[model samples]
Target chain A: MKNIIIASTSTIHGGEYLEYLLPELSKHFKNCKTILFIPYARPSGITHEEYTAKASLAFAKINIAVKGIHEFENATSAIENAEGIFTGGGSTFVLVNELYRNNIMTVLSQTIKKGTPYLGTSAGSVICGLSMQNTNDMPIVYPPSFQTTGVIPFNINAHYLDPDTQSKHMGETRETRIKEFHAYNTIPVLGLREGSWLDVKGSKILLKGNLSARLFRQNQVAEEIESETDVSYIK
Target chain B: MKNIIIASTSTIHGGEYLEYLLPELSKHFKNCKTILFIPYARPSGITHEEYTAKASLAFAKINIAVKGIHEFENATSAIENAEGIFTGGGSTFVLVNELYRNNIMTVLSQTIKKGTPYLGTSAGSVICGLSMQNTNDMPIVYPPSFQTTGVIPFNINAHYLDPDTQSKHMGETRETRIKEFHAYNTIPVLGLREGSWLDVKGSKILLKGNLSARLFRQNQVAEEIESETDVSYIK
Candidate 1:
């Protein structure tokens, strides 16, 4: 039994971090007094303490305490005993590197697999895939491997954006990048846009949010999957 | 004398491949009759032969014969004997991986440093730097290392774009992403916009083309350097 929230972003264009998803999160963590926060993906290279404190502020609104995983000397034991877990956003490379460097990939996955009430955003959501090959972040650091937790079965292209109709930029569009990803790997990639998320409860995974997500598989044209649709059958 | 042409992109918005730079390329190649093409980047994972043909068509416009590195029995020997060299655009990870896998990284750098006419666009141009950390391409595959030729003292963010001011996308802007890169690396990154390029001759590396490029340094505000400016002093 697994319960999880994989969000494309922690914040929307004009919203506060975790503000857009508080309603769902409140219900997801019902009666949960505290949650373990993993700040390995420090967005803009923010310190773990500062990132954790930021997450704490968001969780505080829901009356749930948030603690940084770094607080524990034995991180492995901390996960083993955690009732809930949350991984925040940052560079996926750093996040995955730290996970492998700490030797916590397997245990952390197991804890989440056992239904530890998990939540992930941006880079954090990316680690839920077969590999972090679809991350849009710069390769600021070299990771031990691009491999990540395979809990979600497919990879996620978080914060996915459509091609700007009026832009003059010649850089590859987000859709084009995902198509390139499919050219090499057989894995399906879910283009989760900001404000969109995957809500997983047991074997059911629903596309949650007001917006639709683009799904791309090897050799297939990308298509939008509407919200509220059960995507558990995707894998 | 490291002679090189590092282009931001092979194609500009609504322009044919190499169209915007054909005039510069004609002069860059001068009297050269043929050049070796490195098609390992293979945008959208096109086959070596297919990608090579595409390059041939573009080079033909300038009356230069194009040969794919893969067509030769020994790729290194091809580089060693190349009158001119061109690396095409695609996935930076794949390009770097292939360069290292074929054991051509060292020889390729040596050939360029020895004054062999060289051209690199996008992923190709990125490998001219000390590392491929600043590439905008997706990490569809992981290379053994992120190290590149180090031909230039800094990194290049190919197809550099300004943030969409009126947009609502929450994904990090190109500028913001580079800042994140600076957070971990001290190397300066030159944001080469589409239609812009670096013209390297001997010890001088000049920013060429019609538009200005962005220069980003660690812990500092990024600034725009006008076209034709000799940025060799950036180091």
Candidate 2:
């Protein structure tokens, strides 16, 4: 059985970092005294120490200890031994690169499959998918491969935004980008909006949030899955 | 001398494709009877014939002929012998993949260096940079390498957008994405706004159009380069 939470973002608008999801996370990571944090994403290029401290403070509210994978000599062993694992958001490219460089992607997948509680946000959530092809993050750095943990059957587009009806910007909208992704990929993509998350238990994946999620599949119209609906069939 | 027009976009908010840049392109490609069109970007998955027809329709106004690279038996030779070259906008990842797949990345650079008038919009302009690290397009496909033609000294972030003060979206802003790129790479980046373009002639790179482009450098505050300014010194 697999237990996981893939969140669209770590924070919602006007909310403290991870504060909006603390209640849910508390339940998901319950019975866990400590959680190993993978801070390789390093949003805004923050130092590993600085990123870990933020995660530590957030987890403190849940009365859980937080430790970074970097703090240990063996990251693969760290994943195997972690009671719960949380990968924070930042640059998906950087996160994927570090995961490959550490050669712990396989171990991380095995850890989650073995029933260890797992949580991912933004770049973190994107890594749970089959590929990093649907990521919205800039390719700030080239990763050795676009491969991820394969904890989930499909890909994720985190922090997905709807087209602005009044905007004048000429950039492709979120929907357009996903369509382009579908042009070359057969994998289904879930456009996870901020504040939304997918609750994974065993073989089931459910949408957990107030808002609906946009599901994009090849050769089909993009459909919005209502909150709390089972989306495991997206595979 | 290298002659190129690296535009931020092919179409403005309310203009037809390439309509805004026609006058400038006409002059830059003057005396060139025909121009080679690389439709590899394939915006919205439009086929080569369809995309080429669109380009042909647009170039008709300037009395220039359009031909897609796919029509040629050898894409490498097509680029090398082109009188003028225009690479349209779409997915940068796809364009780069096709360029490498066709084994023309080196020849494309050599062709442009030999002084064939060239024009690129969005993804095309991005490849003219040091790397595609600054592209805003989604990575729909994986390319052999993120390396591109080093025609320009800096990377390009086409369709560059400003942060919306009133928007509630928590996604990383364009500025934040670029700063993240700077974390792992020291290459300079230019955020070229819609309707703005770079006039690259000889060793001079001048910012054209009415809008001021944003220039971001590593470990330094981003600056706004006024239109018509000689920005060749950025190198």
Candidate 3:
């Protein structure tokens, strides 16, 4: 059975318990050979050696032999051989670009179909959605602004935040940005707050987090959903 | 002479002011009828009647016979007949959508060729650029995302607020969003902070604002340009 753990972070990453994620992840692989996807970590300007070192720390406790997909020139072999995939967060755009350039999204998609456990955090979690349109990041740095790996039909607004913090510095509020997104298209957006994880095992989508995820549909007010309920109502 | 005014707001009507902009605008419309385009006011959720009243208030003070393009079924007619155009700000996406739907962008391009004064504010300012790729809004609402009128070759990230405000809110920082935009393409972005405007008259691109605007080219560090002299260095 293929299983996926789409999360915002690893460790006490973004106000959530890493231990909680491990329990669910543990069920997927008896001997997890976790392939750490570090596409988002490029923002730190770290060399390949440094990036690999940092990622290794995150998986030190797990029994799996962790490695980054970048170690190989071709990602096809890297993805196919891995028992499980763990995507760490930094920048969603960067991660999506690497995936697109390597043409590994299709292979990963097929692997997910085979029931290989897929774990995505923050920016990593975003690529597993239909489009990155709902992301809080800038959408126009390239020729094609709306492309994704198509793990899900809905867009995931990762690191999902509210608008109540320092209003003056953050520029526009999240609500305003989402509303602006609504003006262009009617795609559903899942505002997955930090510490939240959407577990997809088989066809079931289980929300595992302390807080409820906010859902925005076309011309509709953002509503909250309970953790245990299936996310079939997103569309 | 064709002239345009892309402003942060209409200073005459409680919108952001362009004290430095009026003189330049006046130079372009020496003997032309100034038409004010108010497409961004749709977000107030007000009836057309109420919105027109607000627009008229600004037009009346300028001692110019100003008409809201929204008053007509074909807004392009207003653009076609007017000697010059001034688009006011409210919402960039809404303004772009209305302009696209009415085919006024094509009209505005022709009007500019006739030396019509084309003035835009906020959303209007953004529409003046190559694309709205750098906008600080949400990605879900598309507003015909890639169908910009293409008056300029580069895109503008309007309302270009600084990134220090992230601590106060849960939304992604402005820097992060723009970085995400960079991941998809290599188009240069001019982040126009509040109170700033870019004046492109007969190939002379002037930067008018209290502070410097941030310019990003590819993967390089975003540099700040303080004055017209600094803008000249960009090309």
Candidate 4:
């Protein structure tokens, strides 16, 4: 069975919550050899060695081999050869750009379709969505926006801080940003507050988080949602 | 028949496109009085008198009366009394913030629903969508994201410039930003270049602009479209 874990962070990195993810992730890859994907770490300008070293600390207790995408020229071979793939979070745009540029986006999409275990966090989590409309990043800095690999129908607003504090700094509020998102198109948006995630196994989607995810339909109020609720939020 | 004109700008006394809009605006309120809604002009920090004075110049030859939303205590009253409403664009987030905070979003929705000649420019045009996810502005600010009047189902990336100037400043390319948008959402984004307007009368949506609009769907290539081609782009 293909197990996909789209999370906000790895090992409470950056003070994010990871309590809800450890158990679930451990259960899915119990005996599998894990390969960590670190595309989102590009913004730190950290070399692959440094990036993977920080990530290894998160999975230190788990007895699994962890390798970064940079170790191999062809990411497809690494992803295909591994029992599971864990994508760490950083700048989703940057990650997606590299994936597209390296032609790994297509490879990853095909790998996930083949039932390979996929684990994503933050920017990694967003890559699982249809688009990144809900991201809290500067639009001027382009990341790969087009080909998300269709892991999920709607865009995931990763690291989504609710009751936004930046409203005074700029103009518009979080709700307004999502509304503007709706004005352009009809795809539903999942505002994933930090610590939240969606786990996809086979065809079933399981929500794992402390808070209820906010859902926005075109020209409608954003609805609060609890985890483990079955929903067809697309369109 | 209620007539509405949504535009990117109004003459700040004199600009290249003042003549084109002034005559049409005058005709929209030929027999009835006119009220120009200057919601997006909040950034100018100009007094209402100054703002109104600038708009009046556009109607100088036509001898038509013009006023801003401040002229009335309630925007609903101003909108109700006017035969036509011209929404001038400036900062989309600012306009949306005021509309959402003052609880005039519904009134605007009602006005548009009643076919009460609703005209919007730039940011104003953005308000017509289900949401503003496609806008070129930052998404950190919160306007009432869920409060757009739903003038249309798709979002508009207004003032959609080529990857010339902004690309140089930001590390990620324009195509990368747009592609990231597609990665996170399934909604079709319309990259409306300047001098473009979508005239909606009943069920028909007519695209009016000097250049072709760019349409993007999830996992699909961005396609350039001809104006007046009735395409079902929002998937």
Candidate 5:
């Protein structure tokens, strides 16, 4: 059976890194003694060691050891033997490019699907979907392809924000961007706001957190899916 | 000589389409009776005809006629022979994809460089730079390349917004995203806030509007350039 937690963001506003999700994550990875970390996204262009150390600190609080996949001689073998996997948030382009460059995308996906515990936040969560097309991150780098694991039938738009009525900015809102994605693709997209996540166990995928997620389907009006609702039927 | 007005956005918030730049555009396209419009960006996923109609309505105020490039038999010829060219705002990916697909990118760049008056807003404006890697739009569609015209020496982060101090959102700020772009690219990037624009005439590129634009150079601290400042020296 597969076990996964796809969070919209690793940290909430004004909170320490991964502080808000520590309790839930501790339970999620409770059985695992050690977890492999993928830090290729490099938010703010931090080095692999720096990002890995940050992850290790968070996982340490839960009594689980975290190791960066970059430290291994072979990424595939590292993932294959890891008790659990955790991919942190950053630039989805950077993360996807590294995944392709290292040729570990397939192995990583297979390992997770084969009952390895997994936790993905932001860019990590987006990769669990059909494609990274719906990500809000800037295209800092060009990935070979937008395709992803397809561990879930739909796409994930992490850190989704609602349109601010009082703002005077002319940029497209989150909903508009996802709507445009639907114009070019038939894949469903879930707007996962910060602090929200999906708890996927075996064949069941349930929405977790306090807020409702906006679900966008091709040619249909977007609607809010309440928390605790089963989102497996989204596709 | 190049006569170009690359604006951050076509319309300011609560303003009509192109309302903010009508006077400047009136002078920019004064000698041209008709301007070729590229509506490939298709904001809101509107049809080319519909988008052209919107542009036509705006240009009509300046006694100029508008025609979408899609109406022509050959996109290259349409751009090469155009008296003035205007590419409206929307998804940058869609616009760049169409430009490459129609094989008009080079011709368009050459036409503008040959002193044909040009006006680009939002996505159109970003294409005037080295690459579209700094765009805030979603990757609804993937272009063959991230490269753009390089008419300007640096990249343009169009419709740039400052960090909201009161917001509880955990998403990366515009500055952070641009910093990540610098990690992979050496090109300088100008964060053009809404209502700001660049007026390029021959070798001189002057910042227009009343706001200060944020300039990000590789490894250097980002600084603000005041309106009317010549930014051509950036590169």
Candidate 6:
């Protein structure tokens, strides 16, 4: 059975890092004394050490120890041995590149499938989907491929925003970008708003948290899936 | 001498398509009777013919005929012999993929260097840089390479926006996103605001329009460069 939590963001507005989700994460990452942290995303270009420290402090409240993957000599072995695993958010490109570079993308996926508890936020959460093609992050670095863990059937557009009716900005809205993605890809995409997460246990993926998620499928009207509904059949 | 107009956007807010830049474009492409338009970006997934028709409609106001590169049997030759060229905005990934697929990236670069009056908006202007790493568009498709025409010395963040102080969204701001880009790459980046553009004339790259553009270089604080100032020396 697979156990995972794919969150839209690590921090919500006016909240501390991972503060809003600590209660849920505590339950999600329970039964583990220590969890390995993958800090490759390095949001805002922070060093791996610095990013890991933040994750460590947040997990400390849950009485779970946190160790960065970089601390281990063998990253693949680190995932294989971690009681639980959490990949922090930042640049999805950088995270995917590092996962491929460290040769742990497959190992990590296997570890989670073997029933190790796993948590992902933002860029980290996006990788749980079919591909990184729907990510909103800039291509800070080029990865070998857009393929991800595919633990879930569809792709994720984390930190998804609704169109601002008052804004004068001419940039494409989140919905528009995902529609463009559907133009070339047939994969379904979930627009995961901040504070929302998917609770995956065994083969069931439930939409958790307060807000509804926007589900987009090829040639179909985008619909809002209510929280706590099973989205495992989205594909 | 190289002659190019790299605009931040093809359409400004509440304005007709290319309406704001018509006067400048009239003078920039004055001698050309017809210009080849590359509709690879295809905003909203419109067909090449439809996108080209939109461009044709816009350029007609300036009395310059427009033809899509897709209309030509030999895209390379079409770019090589074009009296002028215009690449419209859409998904950067798709445009770059089609450019490489069609094997016209280099030929287009060489033609623009050989002084065929050229114009680019958004994704098209982005490719004028060394790489397409700085675009805000989603990676709907994978390209052979992130490398693009080095017509401009540095990368470009087109349709650049300032941070919104009132937003409650937790997503990374445009400024934060660019800062993350500087972590792995040292290339300079210009945040061209909507309605603003870069006028590339030989060795001179001048900022045009009313607004100042944000310039980001590695290990340095981002600064705003006033319009009408020469930015060719950035790199």
Show the colliding residue pairs in model 5: none
Q: Which docking category, incorrect, acceptable, medium or high, applies to candidate 6?
A: high
User: Candidate 1 chain A: minimum summed lDDT over ten consecutive residues — where?
Assistant: A164-173
Question: Residue A51 lDDT in model 3?
Answer: 58
What is candidate 5's TM-score for chain A?
Answer: 0.99
Q: What lDDT, from 0 to 1, does candidate 3 have?
A: 0.64
- Which pairs clash in the backbone of model 1? none
lDDT (0 to 1) per candidate: 0.92, 0.93, 0.64, 0.63, 0.94, 0.94
> What is model 2's DockQ versus the real complex?
0.87
Model 4 — interface RMS deviation? Answer: 11.0
After superposing candidate 6, which stretches have Cα over 4 Å from the reference?
none
Per-model DockQ against the true two-chain complex: 0.80, 0.87, 0.33, 0.05, 0.89, 0.91
- Positional deviation of A54 in candidate 5, in angstroms? 0.4
**Candidate 4 off by > 4 Å:** A11-20, A41-43, A140-145, A164-170, A232-235, B1-235
lDDT for each residue of candidate 2 in A21-102, tens digit (9 for 90 to 100): 9999899989899999999999999989999999999989989999999999999999999999999999999999999999
> Residue A73, candidate 4: how far off, in angstroms?
1.7
| DockQ-best of 2 and 4 | 2
CAPRI quality band, candidate 5: high
Across all models, the iRMS values in order are 1.1, 0.8, 5.2, 11.0, 0.7, 0.6
TM-scores for every predicted model? 0.98, 0.99, 0.75, 0.52, 0.99, 0.99
lDDT of 4 by residue, A133-203 (tens): 56654332344444477777777776554663522222344566676666556778787766667878776
lDDT of 5 by residue, A1-235 (tens): 8899999999998899999899998898888899999999999999999999999998899899999999999999999999899999999999999999999999988988898999999999999999999999999999999999888889999999999988888899999988888778999999999999999998899999999999999999999999999999987
What is the clash count for each candidate, in the order shown?
A: 0, 0, 39, 50, 0, 0
After superposition on all C-alphas, the RMSD of every candidate to the true structure, in Å, is: 1.1, 0.7, 4.9, 14.5, 0.8, 0.7
- lDDT for A105 in candidate 5 is 91
